[model samples]
Target chain A: MFNRAILIGLAVLLACVVAPAQFRRGGGNAPKEGADAPDFNLKVLKTKKKKIKLSSYEGKKPVALIFGSYT
Target chain B: MQFLLVYIREAHPSDERRGRGRGRGRGPEVKQPKTFEERTEVASECVENLKLSMPAVIDNMKNTAGTAYAGFPDRLFLVDKKGKIAYAGARGPRGFSPEKLEDSIKAVLKNKGVAPRKSTKNKKSQGRGN
Candidate 1:
């Protein structure tokens, strides 16, 4: 009985760490390589511009999207 | 290196705001932005204050850019001129590595036949994102 309990506890602990590691806060459902990158309209803080669509970059130049908070 | 910084919701609320029941957390807290305008403001502040030179884009409510790019807290991606993802850096705070990102950019640019832009000044400072 003790052995079984230990095994079960071990399994539970393993699940906790593995789950969070696999599903990280950043990069949820990341796109696969060679997939058509999805596009969206995000405001440009630098120019205080609007209606800047990601699709516009398509067929023009590769666009890299960086995400993060300052502090 | 060509990069963009997406300013999303804050992880914490300012100290004063929290004291007044305005937000959460303490010690220079920045509450998560509820609107795109608010996000833009935060992004602008970072750029101006930090002297961030890289180009950046703001994520929408859906955070489509963030989700698609797998960016949060901080992350880097290198895309080919054709808009296909080339290299994906590790997660931020700990896994984030500027050197790896720079290498990815150089590799992608070279593969695309774009001559690497030469910088007479210190290139390290420009690529390092805090």
Candidate 2:
């Protein structure tokens, strides 16, 4: 009875508390802080076609990569 | 600090349109770009509409950059000089936080280890000058 209550309380605490923090710290299916950014040589949108390499910015300026769409 | 808008495949693609006009309607009736040129057109519209001054880039047909960064709908990330992701914002349209990202940007700038650039051109980006 009391043991079951304690078990239920612990389960609720884990779900309500610990899980979110874990999810935040742990990277899932994506890159997170401190991870090596995957290198890419994408096409720059311009009048003349050009390439934008992610690794090219290495050891230089901190690149702010904004990824999205026009939808 | 440098900025690049990596335009990925459409999220709510115009084909998936619902509703009526601009306010009443969902959005423009633009189809998923079939070619790099088509994608560039849409991306240009986005940049112009937002009045974004930053340079923009387009993801490949296979969305290599998007998939690698888990950037689909939209997201912001700051990579340090070492090419390590310093700040990886959560999935966007929800995790998008100009405030949080700003703080991270300031933090990166404050760290003197990553020095700023001069009037130098990116060696590898010859034809890709911005």
Candidate 3:
């Protein structure tokens, strides 16, 4: 019974570590490769407060969209 | 190439997942932003702290851009000159590698016959999301 409990505890710990990572990456509906980039007219966090649209950059230059936030 | 950092929802707020803080044993204590203004404030702090050179944008309170890109935590997408995704970096944290991103960017530039401009500084930076 003690060994069984230990096994269950380990399993729960493993799930705790692995589950969140999977959920983070498993966010479905992300745009796919070779697809037209999704258009977004998001607010720029600068002094101008000007909104920038993704489509504006089309045919102008390559755009690298890095999605993240501050912790 | 133009770089844009899209600010999304907090990934590890103090209330949830409380990841390690700036120092030992203390988690980066932050609560999820309740309003767009609050979110933007947090994003501004992030940009200032990181000294990000690229322009930063805030996702809507509804998380429209974040939902479209599944951009929680972090991710990288290289859009080609034609507005198509040239390269999609894996979901980040563990999958985020600046070296791999740089390689992919170089590959895309090469395909476009664009010469990479030399830079005096060789600093490597990674974006951290809440």
Name the candidate that leads on TM-score: 3
TM-score of 3: 0.74
Q: Estimate how well candidate 2 is docked, as a DockQ score.
A: 0.36
Q: Every model's DockQ, to 2 decimals?
A: 0.45, 0.36, 0.43
Please provide TM-scores computed only on chain A for all of the candidate models, following their numbering.
0.57, 0.56, 0.60
Residues forming the 10-long window of minimal summed lDDT in candidate 2 chain B: B121-130
Q: What would the per-residue lDDT of candidate 2 be over residues A25-63, giving only the tens digit for each residue?
A: 323445756679899998787637588899998877888
Error of 3 at B26 (Å): 6.7
Pick out the ten consecutive residues of candidate 1 chain A with the lowest summed lDDT: A25-34
Per-model C-alpha lDDT, please?
Answer: 0.61, 0.74, 0.76
- Per residue, candidate 1 scores C-alpha lDDT tens digits across B1-130 of 3456666655444533433453233324455667777777777777787788876677778877776666665676656666666555667756577787677666666666232443546344433232
What lDDT is reached at residue B83 by model 1?
A: 63
Candidate that would win on lDDT: 3
The native-contact fractions of the candidates, in order shown, are 0.63, 0.80, 0.79
| Off by more than 4 A, model 1 | A1-17, A24-28, A46-49, B12-28, B113-130
Considering DockQ, where higher is better, how would the candidates rank from best to worst? 1, 3, 2
Question: How well is each residue in A5-58 modelled by candidate 1, as lDDT tens digits?
Answer: 999998998789855666664434655444565666777765746557766665
Q: Rank the candidates by lDDT, best first.
A: 3, 2, 1
Per-residue lDDT value at B102 in model 2: 77
lDDT of 1: 0.61
Q: Model 3, B125: alpha-carbon shift in Å?
A: 27
Which consecutive 10 residues in model 1 chain B have the weakest lDDT in total? B18-27
Superposed on the true interface residues, model 2 gives a C-alpha RMSD in angstroms of: 5.2
